[model samples]
Target: MPISHIEHYNLRAERSMLETLRDFYVTVVGLQVGYRPLSSYGYWLYAGERALLHLSEARPGDPREPHLRSTFDHVAFACTDLPACEAHLRNHGIDYRYAEVPATGQRQLFFSDPAGNGIELNFAATPDS
Candidate 1:
């Protein structure tokens, strides 16, 4: 069978930084936790389905480090109610850039995640439907 959607994502972060990251994902992003297994440090964060975020504990020898340039440029998600979405962002003090996809007349806004990962919120336009 063809794959339906992305199952989850795994990120490596320092043990001391996991809590801050977790709070952002759970509180700000609005993803709920499912389960977490015992681990030496870090944790696995689930959002309704299987674990969506698997945070690995950083080791002394681990070479990976968070960098401003290394973050993903953007990720997009559809919004049924554009006005509500924009208001929500504003209520949270998040900055965003708006635009229109010329030919399709689709509206979109680009914003950043707590970790600085770019995100795009989009909505299809209709005349009077």
Candidate 2:
């Protein structure tokens, strides 16, 4: 069978960063904190009913050190209300960059999460964006 859409992306962070990461995704990225059921310390981030991101707590001297230090170039989600999104970013004092697609008119907001994972909020082409 052909591959379908991306199910989710998982990230492991220092145990202390778990809550901060959850808040960042909820506040800055606009995802809802949802039930994980997988682990007491795990988080499942949802965009509506679709679970798009999973977070795991890192152990002491977790062997996955190298991967966690890598910056996420970005995780993108189709979005709406460019102005509102921009306002939210500013209101939260988060650093970000925005641009428009010259041909398609799709607008993009680029920023980093609290854990330094890059995030992109994409708004579809509209008469006014």
Candidate 3:
């Protein structure tokens, strides 16, 4: 079958960083912490009813470095309330870059989580935005 859409992305890190990243996604990114059916020690972050991101505890000696450049560039989410989202980022002292698509006029906010995973928040073109 042909691909439809992304189901979710998992971020594996140390427990401390995993918790911190969870809080960042919840508070700053506005995703909700949701139920995970599996027995693994981790969290499922939801955008509405769908879990868009998963956070898992890293195994011992797992050398996945967040800061180091990787082939994966970023993960993007279709979002709304651009102003409020920007305010949340600023209030948390998180740095982000803002842009607007020339063709569609969609507004976008770009930033990274504590684990250095790039995140893009997109707001559809609107008069209020």
Question: Candidate 2 has which clashing residue pairs, if any?
Answer: none
lDDT of 2 by residue, 5-109 (tens): 898999788766777888889888889988787845779999999899998888777843432455357788899888898998999998889888889989899
Which of 1 and 2 is the better model by lDDT? 2
Ranking by TM-score: 3, 2, 1
Tens-place lDDT per residue, model 3, 1-129, is: 999999899999888888899999998888999999989899999988999999998888885666778887789999878878888789999999999899989989999988788989899999654
Evaluate model 3: give its lDDT.
Answer: 0.88
**Candidate 1 residues 28-123, lDDT tens each?**
555666566765676677645657677677778874455478636775666667788788778878789999998988999897765566767778
lDDT of all predictions, in order shown? 0.71, 0.83, 0.88
* Alpha-carbon RMSD, each predicted model: 3.2, 2.3, 1.4
For every model shown, what is its TM-score relative to the native structure? 0.68, 0.88, 0.93
Better of 1 and 3 by lDDT: 3
The model with the greatest TM-score is 3
Better candidate by TM-score, 1 or 3: 3
Q: Best to worst by lDDT, what's the order?
A: 3, 2, 1
lDDT of 1: 0.71
| Candidate of highest lDDT | 3
